[model samples]
Every structure is written in C-alpha cells, then in structure tokens.
Target chain A: MPSLFFYLFTAITLGFGLLVVTARNPVTSALCLAMSFVGLAALFISLDAYFIGTIQILVYAGAVMVLFLFIIMLLDIKAEEGKKPNLPAVIGGVVLAVILALQIVTVSSSYSLGKTPLKNAPLSLNKAAETSVLPTISNDLKVGTLPDAKLMGLTLFKQYGFHLQAIGLLLLVGTVGVVVLSKREKGGQDA
Target chain B: MITLNHYLIVSALLFSLGMAGVIARRNILIIYMCLEMMLSAANLTLVAFSRFRVVEGLPDYAAQSLVFFTITVAAAEVAVGLAIIVALYRSKQSVEVESVTKLQG
Candidate 1:
C-alpha cells in the first residue's frame, strides 16, 4: 500500500513539474504547478507528516498559486511564441540534470536501504514509555499522538523563537514593500 | 518498501526540471513558477529525511519545522517578486528577460 502511494505521488509530482516547465501558456504552467504542489502534499501525508502536508496545500497550492494567477491575469501577457529555445541553455540544463542525479546516487549509497525506524514505530505517545532503551529525556518530550506536528510547534516556539520573530518581521516588511513598489507614481509619471 | 532514497530521487529530478525552466524560459512569470518548483523540491527532500532518519530520541520534526519556515518565507518572496515584476511591466510593456535594459545605459 505504501509503495503504491509513493509511486503514484511521485509520478504526479514529476509529471506536473515537467509540464510546468514545458507548457507555453503561463496560465497552464501555473495550474500545472498547483497540481505538482498537490502531489507533493500527498507525498508528505504518506510520510506521516500531516501538518506539513496540510500547510503545503494551504500555502503553496492555495495562496501562492492564486497570487501568481492574479498577476498573470492583471498583466494579460500573451503566450511567448516568438522566443526560440537557446541551444546552449538546453544543453547546459541537461548536463546539470545528469550531474545532480549522479551526485544524489553517490551520496545516498552509504545509507542502509529500507531501514526507516518508523516501520514499526509506535503511533500513540503512551506506547513510547513501555519500549524504551534509549535516553528518556528526548523520548519523554514526545507528544503521544501526531508527534510530527506537536514537536514542530514545540521546537519552533521553544528552540527557534527568535527566528520566528524575524520571519514575522520579514513578512511585514515584504508586504509593505510590495504595496509601495507596485503603486504608480503620482500624475502618471514614469517611475 | 519505499525507502528514503526514492523520495530523494524524485526531488532531485524535480529540482533539475525547475532549473531547466529557469534557465530556458524568457517569460518572467514562468521563471517565477519554476523557482517555486525548486523550493517545493527542496521541501520534499527535507520532509522525507525527517520521516526516515530518527535523531536518537527526538521525535523527528526539526526538519519539518524548517520546511514550515521555508514556506512562509517563500510566500513573502513571491509577493515581493510579483510586485516587482508588475512594476517592471507597467513601465516597459514587456515580460521578456532580454528587454529589461533600462540599466544598460
């Protein structure tokens, strides 16, 4: 069952990703990107990271893509039909893709295959207390159910509070900057 | 058995495709979409690692938190980036990469 889902999500994500790059119409590309994001979210859910999967759909597929579509609509740009594919760029991209594939294979060759600890890992928090041979400090911190989301919140708020504050500030600045930058100059003058 | 390597392979392929789109496309919007694709690919790799690789007794969500923060920042980035693209379009009436030559003076 797990393997089937893994293959399905992988196929959809990669297929839509390919379409996003190859599609001529910008709108088509944007929609394909959304489909790719949905596939990615499913992959996350299959991995048992429920919070991240939900946020993946909410943020990337919902909010971000909508922003892209709105801009594309506002601009009303035509399909880019006149531009010819640059031979050198296409060649370089293929070369880079080959290099990346080789690098990942080489790096991951050391890890034991199919050795994920979650294979028989307990799902409930209470079960963790009964099967302990490791340090109890970290294990004790684990929340019983939905550990991924709970631990994420704990770590983000406790260990990385300052970083979260910085991100909030960054978002505020970005929102203001976008508003200011997109606004037209008074009297319809050139910016 | 879907191992960690399988997720990494998919992510690597997606990243490469996004890279190709960024390098080959002339339209600014398509490039932006590709950039988002690349970000999503990275996020997938992170989530996969978090799932399979246990950190001793830790509940294996540190990497997931990182992905969360990354998504937040990506949202902010797209907003600002699209605004800049819109501003450029207003003045130049073109979205092609080669046409933005106001600084070439």
Candidate 2:
C-alpha cells in the first residue's frame, strides 16, 4: 500500500521535473518546479522521513518557489527569440541520456540493494526514543537510536550549530547582495 | 514495485531532462529550473542510497539532514540568481541566455 503511494509520487515528481524544463513560459516552468518539489516531499513522507518532508514542502515549495514566482510576475517580459537549436545539441543530449541509463542499470544489478536489510524493518516511532524510525534490519546493527529528524535536530543545533549558523549568515549576505546587484541605477550602465 | 532502482531510474530521467534543457534552451529562467532538476536528481540519489545501501533498511537520518542542507543551499542560490535575472530582465527586457551577453560561451 505504501509502495503504491511511492510509485504515484515518483511519477508525479518526475513528470513535473520534465515540464519545468520543457515549458516555454518562465512563470509556468517555475510553477511546475514547485509542483515537483511538493511531489518529492510527498515521496519523502511515504518513505517515513516525515519531518524532512514537511520542511521540504514548507520551505522549498512554499517560500523559495514563491519568491521565484513573485520575481517572474513582477518583471513580466516578452519572451526573447529562442536560439536556433541544431542537430549537435540533440545528439549530445541523446549521448548523455544513454550514459545515465547505463549507469542506473549498472548500479541496480551490482549492488545487493533491496534484499539486504529491509525485509521487515518496523515503521513505528517510539516517543521517548528521540529517534523516529525503527531499528536497522541488519543483524549486526549497533547504532542505539535509529537517528532521524529529531536526532538530526540535536546534532544540527548542538554539535554542528556553528556550521549551521554560518550557513544562515551566508544566506543573509547573499540576499542582500542580490538586492543590491539587481536594483542598481540604470544610469551606471554604458548602454 | 518501489525498488531502489525505481528511484534511480526516475533520477536518471530527471537528470537527462535537465541536461536537455541546459543544452537546448535559450531561456535563462528555464535553464535555472533545469539546474534545480539536476540538483534534485542528486538529492534523490543520496537519499535512496543512504536508505537502501548504507543504512541498510534503517531510517537514514543523515541522508535526510543532508537533503535538508542541499535544499537550503538551493533555495539561497535561486534567490540570488533569480534576483540577478530579474534585474537583467528589467534592464534588457528579456530572459534569453544568448542575449544575456554573459553566456555566449
């Protein structure tokens, strides 16, 4: 049953992923990318990564993509003349696709993927346990807690707090830089 | 039905689509969306591998955390990148890559 949801979510995500690039309108492509993010988040939820999935929907699909759309709508420009795409581009794209397909097949056949330690891994979470997911199916598994979002929270805020803060500060700086770069006076340009 | 290979196949398709967008498209905004697609493909690969192979049927907390970080960075990147593009659009009134002057290569 859960796997059913997974397949559906994966299909939706991949479909929107294609549409994001193929769509001609910039606004439409941005919206499709947002849909793709939501679909991916749903896939994460079906996989039992509840917290991460929630944040994915909230942050990426919610805040970030909205920002992109706001800009797209605000700066409504007529579509520019598309480049005269040629045969070489098509051939290169096909070559890359074949290489990636081969990689996926090689990866699937070699690794002992599905059968190893996932036969009966439990899905329930214990409240006091802090970690959400159940124990590893590996017989020799030794990790005490099944380290999940809560544990990740602990690590991010405690052990890696500085790095996290640094990232935040970096984002703030980027935001300011973008605003400054984009809002410069037109008089300064040579054209 | 939902094997690790299934996720990989999806990721591969997403990556290929993104590559096509990058190679063929002239619109800068669409190219940026394609870049996001590629990044999402990488994230899917990381989470799938951590879940199936590394953590071995356990909930891969580290993968989730890494995915979160990647999303955060991607969010930041799009913010600044799109702002620049918007500014360019305001100045030149277009979003075509070849016309952007910075992407002639």
For model 1, how does the per-residue alpha-carbon lDDT over A159-189 read when each residue is reduced to its tens digit? Answer: 8899899999999999999989988888996
Instruction: Residues B1-105, candidate 2: write the lDDT tens digits.
Output: 466666677777778778887877777777787888788777777776666643333455667667878888888898889888877776777777656676656
**Best-performing candidate as measured by TM-score:** 1
User: Number of the top candidate by lDDT?
Assistant: 1
Model 2: pairs clashing at backbone N, Cα or C within 3 Å: none
True contacts kept of 2: 0.44
Docking class of 2: medium
Model 1 CA deviation exceeding 4 Å by range: A110-124, A127-144, B55-58, B102-105
Model 2 alpha-carbon drift over 4 Å, by segment: A79-87, A114-149, B53-58, B102-105
Backbone clashes in candidate 2 total 0
RMSD of 2: 5.1
